[model samples]
Target: MRIRYLLLDVDGVMTDGTLYFDENGREIKGFSIYDGHGIRLLQKARIGVGIISGRSSTVVAWRAKELGIEDVHQGSRDKEAAYEMIKAKHRLQDEAVAFIGDDLIDLTLLRRVGFSIAVASAVDAVKQEVDWVTKKKGGEGAVREVIDFILSAQASHTKTPFS
Candidate 1:
């Protein structure tokens, strides 16, 4: 399958599944710079990026904007619906999509996409279903690893300018 779009799940897939709350009762999420650059790299390659997460966080929106990810669907319990929206939005087929996730909730979308991936620390069930499992944990360069894989898969055909 030729992956043209990369769909991501936050929380366990992007971060280490850790949630923090400050004294002000404000929620905080941590994102890795490596993942940020990975998003940028994908953007440079003209590959589409989308996020379908079950939780809705202001930080997630801000981070997506920072990384130039335009297709973000938050608070989506039924992720397959979100995936369909992206597929229609991009006019892409399931065989051209890659989804990376880490939990049971992500399994539905994972199974439907062409290339499903999981981070090294992902749940056993999720790892079992994925076509590829990264060596790094979430928010610790897992997304970057996937980006590299996609780019490498198309390397011979397209010379993407990666610095």
Candidate 2:
């Protein structure tokens, strides 16, 4: 199956699952610059990117906007619904979509996607459902690892060697 789009989870998959609040009750989530650049590269290569997170945060919206990701679905308790919306919006089949998730909540989408991914620090159950497991943990270039694989695959399909 060919992958044309990537759907990612936030929290554990993007920010190491650590939630910090400042004295003023402001949420803080850290993201890796490596992952940010990877998303930019993927966009340049014409691969669609989307974020489907369970929680809603202003930081997530800002990040998605900065990355040029138009498909941002937060506060989605039923992620499958968000997934369906993206699929239909893109007119893409399930086999052409790849999803990276880290926990049980992600299991259902993982099972449905053609290429399912788990980060190095994902739970055992989530890892078992993944087609590829990244060597890097979330918020630490795991998203970049998957992007490289997809870009490499895309490059190879076009008969261009990636060094």
Clashing pairs for model 2 are none
Which segments of model 2 are wrong by more than 4 Å?
Answer: 158-163
Residue-pair clashes per prediction, in order, are 0, 0
TM-score of 1: 0.94
Cα lDDT of model 2 by residue, 1-163, tens digit: 5677999999888889999899999998999899999999988987899999999999999999988999999999899999999999999898888999999999999999988999999999999878989999999999999898888877677632221
Best by lDDT: 2
Winner by TM-score: 2
lDDT of each: 0.88, 0.90
Residue-level lDDT of model 1, residues 65-144, one tens digit each, is 98888999999998988888899989998878889999999999888887889999899999999888999999899999
lDDT of 2: 0.90
